[model samples]
Target: MKNALIIALGIITGAIVIGGQSFYHLLTSQNIVNVASGEVRLGEVYDEQLTTTVTIIGDDNETPILTITDATDQIVKDVKQELAQMVVDANKTLSAHEKMRLETAYFDTNVNIELSTEVEYHSQYQKDMQLTIDETELSHHASEQYHFAEAVDMLNTYASKMDTIYHQNDSFIHKT
Candidate 1:
């Protein structure tokens, strides 16, 4: 009986030790898994933030430029149609030179209005881009700042071209 009791006690003690070790291992492995999962979540969050920022900047830079370009194209088409109609309706008795002068005057007066409006819109776009660049400069990310700078430079170049067109048109109008 005494031998049986000793055997039972040994078995119980061994089971306790094994169970305790297993519990300890489980806790440590679970902690490691949790830490790894947390890091992965953090990485996902960081990527999401970068993607969102880039998308916002792209939209802000591209949308207005496209809108203005489309508007300018439409205005040009309308002006051409109007000028062609005017030429068609011009008095048949006028000399070709006189007719040309009259057409030039009409185009200068009417087209200038459209050009001026476009220039004004482009100028406002430039200002808005400058503001976006200024705001982006406050961010810690260098990539974002670089992108904004590039966008601003492109806007400046486009604005300069528009200005040149307006000036050329103005000079021609004055000469006529």
Candidate 2:
């Protein structure tokens, strides 16, 4: 009877240790995005992963912060790619002089908007953290939520302007 009790306690302790380790790893670990190869396409891939990480971290509030940060970085790169592409496409339609002017305008606009959105995102994140600190001190989830929201809003705003910008480019095309 004594031996059986000892074995049972050992088994329970072992299970707990294993379970704790698995939980710890899940909370702290994340999939790395490898953009160095120049193979990863932007948009859906980053969005899906970000969504999953956000959901996981929000559920447990223990997920790694790097995942969100990396995703945000990638989204910024994607936005830059988009703005660059706009310049490339406009070059095909407008004269060299017109292209220069329009591209410069787009570039300045992109820079301003990107900087402004990032500032707003950080502000929202800090606000969220302050609110959480008054309660549970959990911040990663809040940061992810605000960052994701800001990114989507920024993207949508950029997309909406694309039509108008392209129309202006078309007008220049017809003029020349």
Candidate 3:
């Protein structure tokens, strides 16, 4: 009975040590992003045995703070990719003439509207965030529920414009 008890205790301790090591490994990986104030994101990749975190810094209670977590890198990367593609698609939607016009007026207007929508939603919805861009600080004001995800959705709508432009561009040919 004494030997059995010792064996069980050893097994349990070993298991705990292994589990702790696994968790530590996940946390140390740069994939984790922790925020100071707003919503922090975390992801558990069971197959890869990885945990990722992303931190969004924004204003909360009129000051900056940090919210720590393991899940934001993917989201921001995703947003950047989507938005960049959106910019391309938006440009693609114009005929040479229309595209020429957009270069001056419509492009800037649309970008402003989309940026306003995204910034407002992303800033307000996240409580206690340190809002900064390119390391520059941002001030905060109360706004109703401006969902960032929704704003991204709105931005993505611009992609449809690409199809419109393509149809009109005589330079484009569908080889297939």
Candidate 4:
């Protein structure tokens, strides 16, 4: 009976593993194909925090400034979504460890709007868009420094290559 039970457990585990891999493959294969074919554009992902200023009309009321700020926030949100998708697609080819590292990583952007009286009536407000990513913690441990360094290099190389590929061709194969 014990031997039979052990065999059953092994069979179940095997089935689960196979099923999980199949599901993962199904989910990731299309993204891999899309990215490889350049159907997905990853050049829009900013490497670091980006700050831009958009001017608004100077007026005593703050609604216009808020509106501009909200729009800028939406733009940042869109960029973030693009970046996340790029990461997901790129990670499909990475090892389990590398994918885990990237999955744990975080990126954030903030938009700040300020009224500028110095500007003329047509452009009286300025909005600042900031994007930020923190990697210090990932490399803080002495034992893990090398791993983090490699991960950073890998990610940078992938991003640069993808960005170039995205801009240069509409349907080029992913060389990386």
- In terms of lDDT, the best-performing candidate is 4
lDDT values, one for every candidate = 0.32, 0.34, 0.35, 0.36
lDDT, candidate 2, 1-176, per-residue tens: 99999999999999999999988766433322223353221211111211011111233335521222223235445544544555577678888677643224322211112111111111211221100101112223332333333444554454344334433421112223
- The segments of candidate 4 whose C-alpha lies over 4 angstroms from its true place after superposition are 32-173
For model 4, which pairs clash? 49-131
Question: Once superposed on the true structure, which residue ranges of model 3 sit more than 4 Å away at CA?
Answer: 28-37, 42-132, 135-176
Candidate with more favorable, higher TM-score: 1 or 4: 4
For candidate 3, the per-residue lDDT at 83 reads 43
- Tens-place lDDT digits, model 4, residues 1-176: 99999999999999999999988866544321133334432222222221212222122334432221122223334333444565687679989877734345433222222311111111112122221111111212233323322433443443344344433432223346
Model 2 lowest lDDT segment of ten: 127-136
Tens digit of lDDT per residue, candidate 3, span 65-172? 222222222333455454455456656887776542212322221111212111111111233223221121222222433333443454344333322332343111
The window of 10 residues in a row where model 1 has the poorest summed lDDT is 43-52
User: Each candidate's root-mean-square deviation in Å?
Assistant: 22.8, 21.5, 18.1, 24.2
Query: In model 1, where do residues sit more than 4 Å from their true spots?
Result: 32-176
Minimum summed lDDT over a 10-residue window in model 4 is located at: 115-124
lDDT of 1 by residue, 1-176 (tens): 99999999999999999999988765543211122224111111111000001111222233411112223224334334444554566646678767643234322110101112222211211221100100111112332333323333333444455445544531112223
RMSD of 3: 18.1
Cα lDDT of candidate 1 equals 0.32
